[model samples]
Target: MSPQWFVVYCKSREESRAQRNLENQGVYSFFPKIHKERILRGKKKVVEEALFPSYLFVNISQKDEKFSAIRSTRGINSFVKFGMSIATIPDQQVKQLEQLCHVNNKLAINSDDAYKNGDKVEILSGPFKGITAIFDIEDGLERSMLLLKILNQDNNISFKNSALKKAES
Candidate 1:
């Protein structure tokens, strides 16, 4: 059988380590990452973060590769599976992800692609953490305006773009 792409679940915050160990064992892996601009101690910094936290892709041929070796690799928790079947990622999807990461791994801080007006967003930090709000507009390069409801009243508030994330639907 030919090699197929499969998802590997790794220890928390150890996707890179898992990838390295897999590569050392001659097992090909892909750990997708994105460059994000973050504000740290009042300074803007660019940091690389795993696109899929705690998860990475591996290429393995069941007919040729030892599954036990992969499972025993450091930093790897297990192969992502459902019941008795191991999940596999379609080759085309993996190719698309590779292309996207290669072409634009750095997230644009001011790009409108990050959010759109009236989109629901969640406060990721600060006093508003755990609160859901409606995205209003980008106040500037680093700040955004959101419609937050408090005491049944919709109030306009501004927060750093890094502090908000699109709320899961």
Candidate 2:
């Protein structure tokens, strides 16, 4: 009857609400969120959004847990299932996700492997604000370079990862 992590499929846009309800019921849950940079109303803004929309992790011991109460909880759809059996997540996976949540929450820029050289990007802040440039990541850290066009000539410039944002197609 040891506690194991399970995936909960929550109602649309109700991941936070569902997590609260589960916690109130004494069920341990993990809801990872990330800061997302988005253009809102023609201005740049950073918003906290769920890392996985409509999904959350719950740690529960099936033998000692109240399945009926959890199933009927408001804002929760049901547990993720495969056929007739509910899926159980490994503890190591949960711990890794927890670590990632902590690390990613502190980062202003996404650490995902989506950036590559020659990719179009825009500077979100600093002297290069509003200027589009080509992405050039070096050493996979904060220090990176950018290629900007000046007078029809490509100019290479160094910039921090936080100062860049992906350009819209």
Candidate 3:
């Protein structure tokens, strides 16, 4: 029987562990990850985050005898299912996801559309409304870190990305 892609739901925050266990069982799996820029302790850092948290793809035949072993694998909750049928993914789609992950991993900390370091920005709404600050780095998907000058000291502050805009030159 030919192998097909199947989805495996993992225990909370245990996708990595599940992938490792599957590999040790000789099962091929794909756990997609994306690179993200974050600020930690006032320092910029790049981190890899699961693109699909708590889930990964495994290539196995439907009638494979390893099904029982896979079900008992550590950190694995179960194979995704719909009613009595197990969930499956198209090979093409998985290939596309792999390509996208490849490109994302190679991307720089900040993309061209993202704010650059030292770029002037204005707080749109918040306790710091209208305050001008220097762009620090992206804190996460929806937040950013900025350098705000307060009382002659530069303070690192985090704000919702929606609360900030490029300051007009």
What is the C-alpha lDDT profile of model 1 across 60-169, one tens digit per residue?
99776566688889999999999999999999999999988876764443365578889999999999999999999777568999999999999999999899888999
User: How accurate locally, in lDDT, is each candidate?
Assistant: 0.87, 0.83, 0.90
Report clash pairs, candidate 1.
none
Question: Model 2, 57-103: lDDT tens per residue?
Answer: 98888886576688888888999999999999999998998898788
lDDT, model 2, position 147 = 86
- Every candidate's CA RMSD: 11.0, 9.9, 5.9
Compose the digit string of candidate 3's lDDT tens values, residues 62-167: 7888877887899998999999999999999999999999987887555566789899999999789998999998886688889999999999999999998899
Model 2 per-residue lDDT at 17: 89
Q: Between candidates 1 and 3, which one is better according to lDDT?
A: 3
Model 2 TM-score, 2 decimals:
0.64
